[model samples]
Target: MSTVPKRFEILLVSEHVEDRGGASVEDSAVRSAVVEATGRHGASGYPIYEGHGIVADIDPETRTVEALLVDGRELDYGLTALVRTAARG
Candidate 1:
């Protein structure tokens, strides 16, 4: 059986559109959405999303994300979807 990680990492790769002169608007919007989805302070020096038994640590400057499974014993479909959306953006 495949085991899900208690903690996982996500790398945010932004696509810079030359025509737009910088990062795509969609990318910016997605990042903002991710930030807005989170609550609480940054004890780890970065904003984190902790809810529904999941904790997401996001660092926009470094373009990295760390996802930790808290109360959940497994990564459910909803959690997987959330991560996929963030990673794709």
Candidate 2:
């Protein structure tokens, strides 16, 4: 594959979600924006360096992050960007 898939197997989702951490990852507002951004805009291809957001030296307000996705031999441009962006504050 060329992109890190946004795939979540049925079993994984059920298990992971149930094992929620101390709190939620995104609030209603940010979550909504994310859904619209990726769901509607089809925006992807944000590069991730270390483990932080895609673009370095950004502020906590940056909600989105960009990173290189590696699923075996696959690269997911959209997933990479999504992961990094979401990682930001």
Candidate 3:
């Protein structure tokens, strides 16, 4: 058995996701959703997503997600609330 963290909600303010793709995701825009695999979530300090500024590169891992920007930044935060807000608006 593997020790993986439970699936959590996050803000995927990018165009690409792990498995599913949708219309809500736009260029440089932020979309709220829930992800399972750890690679989909990155550590703290990285900017979640910018409005067509830095290149959002997401590196997926087994138990963690590493995100890098064109300027070399990171995004780490619990995006549950953001997702809820974005979906409503």
Which is the leading candidate under TM-score? 1
Q: Show model 3 residue runs off by greater than 4 Å.
A: 12-29, 38-64, 68-89
- Off-target runs (Cα >4 Å) in candidate 2 are 1-15, 26-68, 75-81, 84-89
- Candidate 1, residue 31: the lDDT equals 26
lDDT against the true structure, each candidate: 0.41, 0.25, 0.36
The residue-level lDDT of candidate 2 at 26 comes to 33
Q: Where is model 1 poorest over a 10-residue stretch in terms of lDDT?
A: 3-12
Error of 2 at 64 (Å): 10
lDDT tens digits, residues 13-76, model 3? 5334664345444333454344333343335532243233233323222222344343344443
1-89 in candidate 2: lDDT tens per residue?
34432211110012124444565433211211211122221224332232211122111234343222222233332222222233233
Provide the lDDT at 41 for model 3: 33
Tell me how far the alpha carbon of residue 38 in candidate 2 is from the true structure, in angstroms, after superposition. 20
Model 2 TM-score on a 0 to 1 scale: 0.18
Query: Against the true structure, whose lDDT is highest?
Result: 1
TM-score of each: 0.31, 0.18, 0.23
Q: Indicate the worst ten consecutive residues by lDDT in candidate 3.
A: 80-89
TM-score of 3: 0.23
Off by over 4 Å in 1: 1-36, 72-89
